[model samples]
Target: MAAQLNHTIVWCSNRSASAKFLTEMLGRPAPTHFGHFDVVELDNGVSLDFADANAQIQPQHYAFLISEADFDAVFSRIKDRGLEYSADPMGSRAGEINHNDGGRGVYFRDPDGHYLEVITRPYGSSG
Candidate 1:
């Protein structure tokens, strides 16, 4: 059997808020409380477990490969929320989306300042 990612812990100042923010942005179901963590599960079966951080939280990058339709829906939500987004990961190109790999892609920050990316095509793959 092929191995797959099960879950990963995301350090955040507020678990609930961070989890809720991610879920809403991705149009996924609301996170559920599990022990001390707030868990958000993606359609691919990988779960992002949000936990409170005792020290300073270092922002991390999370990229999601989604369908064009999903990207449209998610991008609309991002625009409606007035969240700042960029065409590139470094955020140089603001208020724009990139047609990287012939598919739409954008970058934004989560509530915890984690860089969140959504792309309709995987990088380096022909779209």
Candidate 2:
């Protein structure tokens, strides 16, 4: 393996709310019982951990590549939640797709203001 990803720790304002949002959005179950955090496992074997914090957390961008099917599903969820989304992964204005490097993608912010994205093709690939 060449520099495989381990996991991502998300410092959220509310652990329970963030975890619930993530779990429902990703269509996965919430973590069993951790000390003070909840773990969300992805299909790629990577995990996103939610931890409660008091300090103002700086928003970050986290992208996940998904199949066209999963993308459609999640997009529907976004719509159902009436959440504003951007075509660009950078969370620009609504209904904008940044064909950055020429790939299909979209952006939506999580409950904690974390920018999230789902793309079909990998960046810089000759697809």
Candidate 3:
């Protein structure tokens, strides 16, 4: 078989909280404990293993390609929670969503300050 991404370790101050935040944002099931990590599995079989760390963490970016309905539901939750979002990754266009490549996209931050993005389509997929 070809090489595939199985999982990645995410460094966070609190593994459980970070994992739960990601799962909830993506409307996925709750995270499960695996050893010292909190694992959040995606639909594609890849998993994010969140581990607690005492050192300072550098924020990372994670983007999700979802359906329009899923985007709507997630966006609604974002607004309801009063979280700041931006149309662009740099966050200059705050409180807005982008229609990039003819699909909606938004960027927000997780509890550990990781940049999270949700989009209805892949970049350059539409003309």
- Which should have the higher lDDT, number 1 or number 3? 1
Which sections of candidate 1 miss by over 4 Å? none
> Model 1, range 1-127, lDDT digits (tens) per residue?
8999999999999999999999999989999999999999988899999999999999999999999999999999999999999999888899999999899999999988999999998999983
Instruction: Provide the lDDT at 22 for model 2.
Output: 73
Q: What are the models' TM-scores? A: 0.95, 0.85, 0.96
Residue-level error in angstroms, candidate 2, position 82:
0.7
Model 1 lDDT-worst window of ten: 118-127
Minimum summed lDDT over a 10-residue window in model 3 is located at 17-26
lDDT of each: 0.95, 0.79, 0.93
Candidate 2 TM-score over all chains jointly: 0.85
TM-score of candidate 1 to 2 decimals: 0.95
Model 3 ranges off by over 4 Å: none
lDDT against true structure, model 2: 0.79
Error of 2 at 109 (Å): 0.5
In terms of lDDT, the best-performing candidate is: 1
The regions of model 2 sitting more than 4 angstroms off are 1-3, 98-103
